[model samples]
Target: MILTEEIKRIKSTEKEARKFGIQVGLVFMIITLILFISDKGNSHYFFIVGGVLIILGQLFPQLLIIPNKLWMSLGVVLGYFSSRIILFVLFYFILTPIGIAAKIFGKNFLEKKINIEKKSYWNIRNNHYNKSQTEKQF
Candidate 1:
């Protein structure tokens, strides 16, 4: 998706980029401050979590640290199941082998079109149009 105008404006200008970072930092500071003003020690834990997320978002360490495309792709897939450890384990134990097999064997599988639903090619100038489906097979 294309960025909205406001985001594009920030992305286009170095000055705006600094301003954006500062404003985002201020937002984090405000949250931390509010947490601190109410209670001190709990907020410090929040600070650690917020800091890690911010740093990761700032520098996407995934592209550097992961090292392998397969492993990176695995991490990206596992990320969806991060919240549920059991599902992640199940996927690791069960579906991973199937996926590997698919990668190895399914590469040579013939492409077949099973579903065909015919519709008009276009709407003509007046009210009706001729319909045809020209299928090209590899």
Candidate 2:
């Protein structure tokens, strides 16, 4: 039973990978068409490669396994590095300058006040409420 389930999973994964390969081939073909339309040099190579990919993707998709794996690995590595760079840019270029400017201008967004002489940090407010105030708490 376990072997059967594993086989099914593997079959499904292969089917999905085949579909992905076909999609990638179609994209390459589309790029080739665009390049041809623009009359670019070396387009014949792209056309030949794209045609071969499409044919292989349709006939023997298993042959595309290595290329698919390499593409997925590249995407993973690029995604990790791109996300890190984007976050670094956001925090360092955007938020860091805003924080420094706020510090220089004496702007406290969190409303935190520090006093060494104060024993308690809590401030007590009046709790007396009328009936109308209780009815509309917001």
Candidate 3:
């Protein structure tokens, strides 16, 4: 089946999300390294920032790749609270898995949806053919 605009959009967004995710991970790693090397006893603030960055890294990609509008909306709402470590972790765990699942299955899912739409349209058009044939038979 020909790729629909929506499917093309999703594929492109998924690529961008992957790149952004990699950048986030790298930045988080760098910050962690800086915190370790500095070894300041009062570095709790740095740790907090590192933790938040880690969650944001995961959350950002998940938000871009998630196919479900409801989940995407929920991700946005949850993102506001991701500075809280617990909610950050929760969002990372929940949304990341769903986003991965969407990536894996997205092409097939969209192809099926498109095929179904095409079939329905053709079925409607073919109904006229069937009726004309039957009407002439009698």
Most TM-score-accurate candidate: 2
Error in Å for residue 63 of model 3: 2.2
How many times do residue backbones clash in model 2? 0
**Per-residue C-alpha lDDT of model 2 across residues 3-49, encoded as one tens digit per residue:** 33433333334555677667877887888888889988777777777
List where candidate 2 sits over 4 angstroms from the true fold: 1-12, 114-138
**Candidate number that wins on lDDT, 2 or 3:** 2
lDDT of each: 0.52, 0.75, 0.55
TM-score of 1: 0.27
What lDDT score goes with residue 5 in model 2? 44
Candidate 3 RMSD computed on C-alpha atoms after optimal superposition onto the true structure = 20.6
Error of 2 at 47 (Å): 1.4
Mind giving the per-residue lDDT tens digits that candidate 3 earns over 21-43? 55555665676677778884545
Candidate 2 vs. true structure, TM-score: 0.71
lDDT for model 1 comes to 0.52
Q: What local lDDT score does residue 101 receive in model 1, on the 0 to 100 scale?
A: 90
The TM-scores of all predictions, comma-separated, are 0.27, 0.71, 0.26
